[model samples]
Target: MSDLRRRALAGGKTVSRKARSKPESGLSSGNHTPNGSPGNSRAGSRANSRPGSRYASEDEYASESENDDIMTISTNSVSGEDDPGNTWAERLQDRVAELQDRKRSSVQGREATLGAYNHLLKHHFAQRQLDKSVAELMPILLRGIRNGSSDEERLRTLQAFTLTVLTCSPETIFEQALPILKAACQDADAENVKVEAIYALCIAVSYGGGSSTAAEETLDFFLEIIESDGQSVGAPDSGAVVTAALQAWAFVASHMEDLTVQSEAAIEAFIEQLDSSDPDVQTSAGVNIALLFEAAREYEEETGESFDMQYNQHRIMTRMAEIVRDSSKSVSKKGRRHLRSNFSSIVTSLERGKGPGYSTAGRAGPNPHTGGPRTDEQGEFREFGYRERIRIYNQFLLINTWSLHSRAELLKTLLGGGFGIHYLENPIVKDILGSADVEYIPNAKSRK
Candidate 1:
């Protein structure tokens, strides 16, 4: 195995002491399960542990009807299911049985697991279905991660577990799944498993009705992973883990309404990553820095108060510009090109104080006298910021804010082909976006 992969697999399983302490900003305890809280035990009902604003408010139905909701959802037909016995729950149950049969070949078990996940992505699961199934499903899935025959099987199992989190009600799984997922983050046997676990935590906290304080604590935990670069945590020097941590941190940070509390330290940490040997790490850091700037701008618009975090914006912009034109030979030509493209967007975002993509107002051509490159009205290089498109039913949802953009990217990575389907049908997704389908269109049209 490659060195990077080895380190990733050897990631630390312990949460840092610093992460466990209450955040300095009066935020809630960052621990996955607060001390003495009902979420303290695996068997504890997470859905009832805390009063949540989003997921809890929506889960007001009677407990007796939980099974009814599950049956109703499980009985619904998914596209291309011709067999009467091939309902989602039955297929899932069959796969689980196949997986549990010790006599089955490893290949058969892996395929069975994948088949179950494929079925999951085909339809959204209601809260009742999740509540009824999670008790049985989570343990088996966790076992797959620990005992699966190959790294591929373990990774697929992790992916399936994340899909289960996303497709079902977040509250149903949040309390029960968070600690186990954190244990996966500390997995010393598989680096990819650790990476996938971090992503899973991001999804759970974001969709599972975690408070802004919980989100802040989650971001802090990821930042520790990123800043340590896997060494302090007893993991190897793996850029993949750092990159995953960085991206996951940004994914959760993007959802926060205010970043001022974390801005100065977070931006400084991200700026240091601009010097990373891994190009992926560099770009992820750059994008996150831009996201901070975007958050600051949004905060200013909302509160009309200047953000207190102070840093040399000029220096950061200069470093991004240098990255845009870097010609170092140690980096591959493709890597260099990607850095240029990513940094160009970062530079644009910093220069314009907005997310990347060209200006909505028609751009004026290059300087008439200097005959320079294409520039916006502000006379800066017209660099395009990365944008993701999601089709919700008939309308195309444009993700433009750094927060929404981060969520879209993370969802796409987690859900793969099912992102569009979830974006269309999942309430958790809609809640995260806050009517983004309705909010972003006019802005996109204006930017056209």
Candidate 2:
């Protein structure tokens, strides 16, 4: 074993050599129950003492049928049938039973316990034990993750228990795990540790951290990690770390409610990424930027902040329009298609609610400093739905129309100059270059 440990270190893999004896109760192996009863484990005892732990003292539902929403989603389909007799809770108890059967806390023994806890959480999640009663299981899982002696064990335990954290209420889970995950994302830890922590934080916030403030806090850390490599460009570790940070950003965007300044900053950063020399960085940035657009919500900033309605909408639109024009001539068809599709969705939706300083063609709008939904006759916040929907449809037409005009402008340049003028009199060419109109670019034919 000592030789194996040395060999593992030579290979640069994380290793552990901690030795532990089996407990008198055989808790190391999952075969034996903690209190000689399936659900009556040590964690269960601890749970009974914690506040708001439904799993400890209450069987909230009269039966599985009463578990209505929680029991609706099942893993039975994925796992296949033959186990209609057993519930998810029963299967989790079985894994815990195996955990108790382990005789030692060696690397192998620790792995066995991790596997057991992972399966337990999997079943628990599929069951959607909606009581938010994590107390019955949280401590034991936390112990495994925290007590992990090797980097390898820590990573595995972190992933598993952080998953268990999802079964917790967002507020509770964020309070307990956010600080630890954030600390781990810092420079003091190994690269792998930081990456795993970011991964876990992604899942936690995406699933349970409803607090936009938490999302805001988490977003700041990741953006720093991503921007750190600005000087080196394509340096190795930087690329991987930046990709992970982008993933975290996308997850947070999916869960956040308001992202006025944050979203714009992210948009600009991703736009910068579009210019990266590295193809991988470009690809990641492109996809994530699109995903960000798809996930974007209305801008909500309570604090007095500057937001120019025209600048915000027009800047993004112009960039996207440029990308579209480039795509028409560029070899990379995929990048063009992706930008066009996501851009259409965003450009159309962004202008629906015109806050202050919006040039909506004499249309009435809310105060720009306090842009929000308009209230109805009864004095409740309600949208002018008909007007808004009409505006959205018009915005779509405006974007496409401008794109056509751009095409016309480019065509005029081609037809009016050089040897290209020889084909100008062709029938199809003449029809497209009609004597200029209110919508065509340049306002008049440049045949001269």
Candidate 1, residues 168-230: lDDT per residue as tens digits?
A: 644656666667777767764667767777777887787765777778888888888877886
Model 1 is weakest, by summed lDDT over 10 consecutive residues, at 48-57
Candidate 2: misplaced stretches above 4 Å? 1-88, 97-103, 116-133, 187-193, 205-210, 230-236, 277-284, 287-297, 300-306, 309-448
Best by lDDT: 1
Q: Model 1, 314: alpha-carbon shift in Å? A: 1.9
Which of the numbered candidates is closest to the native, going by highest TM-score? 1
Candidate 2 matches the true fold with a TM-score of 0.46
